[model samples]
Target chain A: MSERAQQLLEIADDELLLGWRNSEWTGIAPFLEEDVAFSSIAQNEIGHARALYELAGRDLGKTADELAFDRAPEEYRSAALVEPRFVPDWARTIARHYLYETADQIRIEALKASDDAEVAGLAAKIDREEVYHRMHAEMWLERLVGEPRVREALVELWPKALGVLGDDLRPLLRERLAALDLPEVEPVERGKHSGELAELWEKMTVVRRSVPGATW
Target chain B: MSAQEQAFLEYVQGGGQVETSDWMPAEYRARLIKFIEMHGNSELMGVLPEREWILRAPTLQRKLALTAKVQDEVGHAQLIYRVVEDLGKPRAACLQDLIDGKSKFHNVFHYPTKSWGDVGVIAWLVDAAAIISQKALLKCSYAPYARIMKKICWEESFHILHGRDVILTMMNGTDEQRTLVQEALDRWWGPLMQFHGNPIAQGDDPSFSWRIKSQSNDEARQQFLDGYVPQIWELGLTVPDPKLRKDEEADRWEYSEPDWAELKHVVTGNGPRTKGRLQLRRTSRAETDWVRRALLAEAA
Candidate 1:
């Protein structure tokens, strides 16, 4: 209901959806060590969502679970960028992963300075953990940079990656991308849901919706 | 078989620890891979039975814990496969062998999990059986596998605690919840009994001969009983075995014989849920194949 609550919800929704999408690779990632490391990142994303939901829930009169699983598909405030189930496609997954972490880093930096101290504090903590994600993503990005498939995938997904960061942060994101030697591309932008979100929401909410009144 | 191998064999028989680059006969290397590969397969296959539960977990805590648990299984698989890799087999080859069903995993993982109760019982009892063997592996001659076992055993300690907490909560809940736990135990009893494998003599088992398994099959089963049976009894849940008892003089557990033929059938990939579970793994891997090829240096 409050502006702060809405802001938290959108960010939380993005994280929850992205976390859900990323976890699809839990058992099937390319390598075992990376699989473990990546799964931890996915869990942490969901964790961030939960903590954000908890903060947002206090004002909305809802629990974190209610906020996470109780929402209808269209009611979700996640960006389209974080919604796809790109399980088996390492190229697209990494492109999206590299892009999202970049966008998230930019956004979290802004959140870290929010007027709500708790919001700012939590964002700061999350940003610290994202450092590893960035390292891991960048590691893959560097390795794949010389490869044609990864480069092509990056070019194709750049616009959507740009869309993840809001207009206010575009200049800074662009500046950062340039510093990293990445070429310019249009962003897919926030506020729109990708086709992937609907399917993800369906599976995610299925169990929680079943026997709704009973505690698991 | 040779005079040198005979001496090497006697050393392991006397509790000698063998490192990776240490002197070993060809037989020891083959036996090591067989035992450890099965373990790696067990961890990888183990993920399937519990993964669906992550989707169905009732609460955020439950979802997170279950997901982490399953994730840990994948991690364990990775860790295990690395050890196997060091033992002269490539990970890809090991995976190839696994999907082909040319190797075996533990029996408990082959059966279907019926309810949330099954999940708890598995995390509790199955992991308990595994930990008994794993703790023994902490002293294994294979340094790499044994080193990894320390981490595996430490992490498993948490899994068992989480499992015990889950079981206790269900048991202390409503009648329906209690029934869920009891029903799950009944269905799982046979598999749990067969978990440590048939009580083969340590001397006759090559795994034991190489000091790869410090405890005998029967010894591991008895330890599981000794550690967990009382805990089960205190919770007021029946183990479904009428002859289940501990002999004070022999210090051995006596229970009705587990269906060895059934254990053989299930582990060889013919349990009721084996094909379906393996099918899921096959499909998911196929679906995710591009990711590996795209990212892995060697695969690329």
Candidate 2:
């Protein structure tokens, strides 16, 4: 794959997996208002994934759905940060959410400066939507600041959260966390899949594979 | 009724709308809270059956569509609970009543969804039935609820289309796929038939007497039949009611009397999936209680 296509696929895979995980809370979020708000964020993530996949699919000679659902588990390039099932675990979920959105904003900002106009333009659009996500994350972070569970969750997920970005972007993530006064830790970088990803992939693709090539 | 209550009733019956701040009879306020709270509860409970399918959606589009549809239901619950809250019932209390079996939701949601075909039938037929009733609610005497119903109805239009598309794709596919739709229709037909509740004289129905519901239960059921029975038949799916037919002379639908007893039983929190669903809600709510407190707590 070309570097550009690989980059797009990595981001797309991250979003698709994260969106799927986030959606597990649709009907069952902590509160009704939060359920609605979080579901929108989940949808937005899936929407971003679809758009990214469409861009990557063009270079890979496949359709967006083909790129999204037809790939073998090992072929997906999503980082491990998005692979865990955190349903019914709001503290950890929000910890990951806050961290992921912060990291994503940094990555999206860099993409906005890409020489490729399509990538840059798409990045700008996605960054616009991420504004709300960041606000939501910050809102929870403010509220959960002194809570021990949230503090503990942030500590546990910090390394995986760092895995969401590339080596060059990791320093930026570290710098952003420094503002929150979170201590630095060894980063759990990409290039390794959690067993959770394989399990999630099986459920995600079951129905599609049931009637292969038939429209759902 | 006192003269004050009588006068209030007359105004509502004459198409006057009530605002949240307006003086209402104690009984009127109580009934309004219960009715609106149940609607909110129903929307929340309705999400459970379809949520699993969002995970197992066959395509990216279906996944997005299902997620959006479920999200709308959650949104509707928020809107409705807000309306109820403004009427003196807090969202927390409403949720409490629901979990404790002190409240009720719609009967259709009390049952199980066994297959992908159930997903289609529900979005298509069940939502079609609900939209018919919701359209009637656009004229509800409670102005806030009526306004929210407008938004709710608009979003629901897409759910029906997405549902129909799913059913059509399956019906037009292989034999097994078509059978899926047929079997689902057969199973869902009973609950769908009973969805609108038994007919009562509009004048005698408190909900209609207060103009909170602008149509009788039978009228909503008839509209559902008029609008959708043909659509179902066109797809070669049977509705499982042998007696179901439209009476051209009276412009009414005649069907086997839905088992009111069953509807009563199920909605009273004894449906096949009701207990389990409630437990799921309770467990999830308990697990996340701290998040609510932490996020909503006043700053120190």
Candidate 3:
């Protein structure tokens, strides 16, 4: 695969895994209204993944489904930050959402100027959807900002959030922290999968692999 | 009814709407909660049957569509329960009552879905049938419920298109694939027919008297038939009701009487999959109890 295809997969795999993680809250979120709002965010992430996969698949001689589900656990390029199953925990979930969307906004803005028109175009489209996601995550962050536990959760997850951005992207992400007056930490950049990735991969692909060659 | 009740009845009788804070008779309040509560419960329980498919969906398109459909159901539950919550019941209490079987959900969700065929048929005809009743609810006497219905109806529009797309793809595929659609439709027709509930005359129904439902049970069922019977026939899938027909003369549909007794039994927590579905809800809730406590506890 070309350099473009590999870069696109990293983004797609990150989103696909994170979207899958977020969806685990569909029926079991903290409350009903918030559950609805959170589900939409999950759908948006998956939708972003689909669009990204389509862009990458053109160069890889495959379809989005093949890219999303046909890969082995080790082959997936998603970061550890998005691979955990953190249902029922609103603080951690919201923390991760805020962190990831913030990190994603940074990366997507950079991609928006890609030489490849299709990749750049898809990034522009996804950024539109991510705006709502950022607003939603910020809403919860503001709502819970006064609480000690929530504040602690946000602090604990900050480094992992940094991990989502690249070494060079760290400068931009650091500026975001300086604006918030938050203390900086070592960044957890992409490339390494978490221990959680294996478990996520098993469940994520179980159903797809169940009946090989049969149409859904 | 007394003079005041009689006057109130006349207002709704002539198509009046009520808001959450509006004055309502004791009977109207009770009936509205019972009726609307069941709908909220139905949306919540409804997620279980369809959610499994999200885990097992064959293709990327199918997976995303199925996930969105299920996610919309969760969103609908949120929208619905809020209406019920404003009606004097807390959502936590409603959920507790649901887990305890003190409340009810629709009968269709209480049954099991066997294969991908069941997924397509339920989304196609079941949601289509449901949208007929929900469309009627857009004009419900209660204002808050009615407003939420607008959003609910808008979201459901996508489910129908998604359902139709799924079923159509299967229908146009292999012979076995077509059979899946046909067989699933055959099994679902009886439940879909009985879904709208026993027909009561317009004047005799309390929900209609207070305009909680702008359409009668039979009226909604007829609308479903009038709108969808032709759609079904075009797919070359026969409904289980052999007597089904559209009398262009009456501009209405005719079909065999649904077994009202069976509907009563199934919806009252005795359906085939009711126990198992409820058990799943209970288990998941229990497992996740800490999340609510962790957040709510902090709030408290």
The Cα local distance difference test for each model comes to: 0.83, 0.91, 0.81
Tens-digit per-residue lDDT, B88-197, candidate 3: 88888999999999999987998888768889988988898899999898888888898988988888888988888888877777677778788888888888999998
Highest TM-score: which candidate?
2
Residue pairs with backbone atoms closer than 3 Å in model 2 (clashes): none
What's the i-RMS of each model?
A: 2.7, 1.2, 3.1
lDDT of 1 by residue, B42-84 (tens): 9998988887676557667777787799888988988898888
Instruction: Report the CA-based lDDT of candidate 2 relative to the real structure.
Output: 0.91
DockQ for each candidate? 0.43, 0.78, 0.35
A1-216, model 2: which lDDT tens digit per residue?
999999999999988998999999999988777878888898899999999999998998998999988988988999878999999888889899999999999999999999999999999999999999999999988778688888898988888888889889999998888866777688887758889988998999887787666766
Q: Score chain B of each candidate by TM-score.
A: 0.96, 0.98, 0.96
Fnat of each candidate: 0.46, 0.87, 0.44
RMSD of each: 3.0, 1.6, 3.9
What is the DockQ ranking, best to worst?
2, 1, 3
> Can you tell me the DockQ of model 2?
0.78
Off by over 4 Å in 1: A145-163, A174-199, A209-211, B246-252, B280-300
Q: What lDDT tens digits, residue by residue, belong to model 3 across residues A1-216?
A: 788888889889888888887777777666666656766777788888888898888888888988888888888877768877776566688778877888899999999988878888889999998899889888877766666666677788777778777787878877875645566677666667777888877766764565565455
Q: Which candidate gets the maximum lDDT versus the true structure?
A: 2
